[model samples]
Target chain A: MTLRRRFVLVHILPIVLIGLVLFAPKARPGLRPCGALLAAAGVIELLFLAALARRKRAVEPATAPCDTVTLVWALLTGWELATSVLHLAHPVLVPAPENVFDTFREQPLVLLRNIASSLELLAIGFSIGLALAVLLGLFAGWIPRLRAFAYPIANVMAPIPAVVISPYLVSLMPSFRSASALVIVLGVFWPTFLGTINRVTSIEPQILDSARMLQPDNRTMIFSILLPYVLPGVISGLKVSMTTSLLMLNFAELMGATSGMGYYVQNSITYANYAHAVAGIIVIGVVVTVLNALITKFQKFAIRWH
Target chain B: MNRIECAHVTYSYEAHSRRETVLHDLSFTAADGEFLCIVGQSGCGKTTLLRLLAGLAFPNGGAVRVGGAPVTGPGTDRAIVFQNYTLFPWMSARKNVMFGIAQARKGLSKAETAALADEYLEKVDMLRAADKYPYQLSGGMRQRVALARSLAMDTGILLLDEPFGALDARIRGELQRLLETLCTGEKQKKTVIFVTHDIHEAVFLADRVLYMADGRIVRELPVDLPRPRADLCCADADRLCAARRELLGWFDRTETEVQV
Candidate 1:
């Protein structure tokens, strides 16, 4: 199809979705209105289309983004039809899109505050975990005596899943918040520690040879040569480490804590407010996507080498 | 006194439960301020000898010495360039050179280190690409940066193990001339040991060329050509041509023997 035609397809599909949500007659009794959800979806799609239009001249192969948006809109229309118009599904189990998204229009501050709290914990835990791993890994990797001592210990500890033992830790620790943070730390530390050691040991032979020829002192070798050499590997592994830590954090929060995204979801489930729980799940997805994008941008700036 | 020495040096590699000797009783020396190139076929232990000189590897059976002292380990007295990965991939060209200068001359201010780095980069015509990381550069450009780094160090001994082995012919020739000027132009000449398989390159760069075969230096040829001899200018010279032919003859004979 022609370029204009493809864009028209993207522009037209969302309108069908909006029309269904705004005007579809409800067969289900006492279903919530679609105003908040429709408004939110409209604004987001508008921003995305604006970006697409602005970059039209240099738009990517013209299939992936446009088709994806069309597909999303088509799915939204199907969901609206199935829930509010036909009422074919179980009314309580499968909530109307209107009620789920209304949770956003109603109590955004509670969600935001919970997100902020979770992020703070993640940051504290992740930073401490990564810093300790890299520092200890460097010393251990460079000195054979330390390597011998630390390797066995790391091997044993690195295998245990923080999530599996997190419930016990939650009860054992004085506070739930501390237990949650500890879970994130334990989740991030081991893989990064082992990864750092592997990177140091497996540095390119020629690069190692050149560094040796320079005759770096012990401190310089660790901080200067070995650190930068392993930094790219560490940064590249950040996504996996971050994802793992976030899993541990949410799992711990789901089990015990009171105010994180995971808690928001679990509490909503306890109160039979599945709509709010679904909204909380959506928030968690958005946060993870944004964090991953930020990490990718940071990786580009940090690692200038191959 | 000899600037570098290797006496009865032997190196072995144990792999897959087999002990393989790489260099067997190798012995050679480069005189102070002389450029010595060891030309050999692959697997001839030429690079192992260079590493021994650089103190990157210890001789299993014999001693390797530099400046009349038995080499203990890597020291600030030597700088080296390898076939690949001489510059750290994470560092820019200027930083790599600066890092080398820092390791060799400890007390230089950061500004002084940077200035020295730029000077060496300029010598290799890589000043424009000083900020580029090694991955951004072509193989030849990377080699120029590597050369700049080792030269910037200004150590007493310089070791190069097939430093230009991966470059195209034209770039290789340009670097060859650049290397010649950099080594000889300095008032305090560094004792250079360049290992290569290229006979013409050895003839072009070295004051003396050592030919190695199967882990031993079998012949030494002295090039009597004039200093800073133009490329192809010394090609027609009788002595250089004879040395080139003799080196070529050795490699050809070895290839035939291996095939047989």
Candidate 2:
């Protein structure tokens, strides 16, 4: 069979099987909601596959998404069979896919509030940290004495995990939110600062020669020439720094915070609400993926010159 | 009066705790509007000499003077076109040219700089690719943009370190002719220090050619050929041929000396 046919067979078949299993005579009652959710997911998958197939003639089929869909379908089928169909797993620990998906419909406002809280903290911490890192990095990289003084200190500090000190920071700071933001900033700042320093120092000699010929003042040289020269490197490094900051933020939230995605999951697990905890975990995954996608788009736009 | 003077300039590079001198008390002077070519084999310090004149680097001894002023650092009065990476990769061709113009003619309005940039790009026949970035351009086209940039600057002194050296034969000849036209046209001719290893190019474009080897200028040859010499078919073809032959002879002698 052709790749497209094979993708349909592997991807679409599992999704159909999942629907069948969901609608089949359940080992217990109250499965109609689960059946409805599975049917809706199957319809969405069908539409997506149709779109992919239509574009296949113009572009090669990306195997990753096809494989991802197949894996997701298989996991859902297995989870439904194990929890609701066969009753093979622990009753409270392993929740059915329906219960997890129900949380989206049942407690959407609460989930949204938690996401907003997490995003707000992330935005503030990430923006402040990245801005400070880039500005300070440019200055520290340009000046010899400052670079010499800070390079070694950053080297020493960059490797210390922000999570290790969050407890102390939380106790020291007046608010848990400030401690979380501080943790994220420290996590992102060192690497970005060091990367900027190295990038500025290693700018191509020919470019430096051309800029120097212009006889720009110190401020113009730093802002106009050096900043643009190091921008591509900075943007490429942003994804890593962002991921680190997110990790630090979540870890801090898990330690002590009244609101956040991490706190939501921690709160669910405290009451042994595995369904809510699993839903919260999935929410975190979706949020991180969406943020990463945005970062990728920004990178493409920023380095369009390349 | 001389526009640029390199007086007994010497320079060296330090590598692995050792100093290797590149220019040994080299001295030369170019009168205003003269097109001077420094021709030498590879590793003969032709580029080093050009850099000294450009004020991109300082000599360990003596000084490079432009218009009776000692060279300190790179200035707007002298514009240089290096062999590679002369244009900023992040900027379009038009922006690169405008950058130089803005530096040289400060206080000009944006529209004025843009117009001047277009004019020079037109002169070099690179107007169509004005919005293209450096990476989008071919090697020859990038060199054309670099040439347009220096030309647009309208600096009195143009230091070219084998600007066309990386191009193929056809493109190199075309650029050489373009450069010759621009340098000798109605506009005030810039004092150009054109460095090349090709003898034919030197004889074709330069008013005076300096042959250097082993950190010293071996000979100086002045070409009296008329402008627009009509390529190798013109009346001055024999003189051009003789100059090329003499330059080749110097190269052969240097090779024999090295073998011995």
lDDT by residue (tens digit), candidate 1, A89-158: 7887778888989999889999999999899999999999999999889888888899889888889899
Model 1 per-residue lDDT at A50: 69
Runs in model 2 with CA error above 4 Å? A11-16, A28-32, A39-59
Clashing pairs in 1: none
Candidate 2 local lDDT, B131-242, one digit each (tens): 9999999999999999899888878888898899889999888888888888876575889999999988998999999999988987999998888755556557988899
Q: On residues B1-260, what C-alpha lDDT tens digit does candidate 1 reach at each position?
A: 43788889899989999999998898887789899999988888888888788777788998898899998888778888888998898889999999999999899999999999999999889999999989899999999999888888878777889999988999999899888888876595879899999998999898999999999888899887776766446354767778889889988998999899
Question: Given the true complex, what DockQ would model 2 score?
Answer: 0.77
- Candidate 2 chain A has its poorest 10 consecutive residues by lDDT at A28-37
**Model 1 chain A weakest 10-residue run by lDDT:** A51-60
Model 1, position A188, has a per-residue lDDT of 82
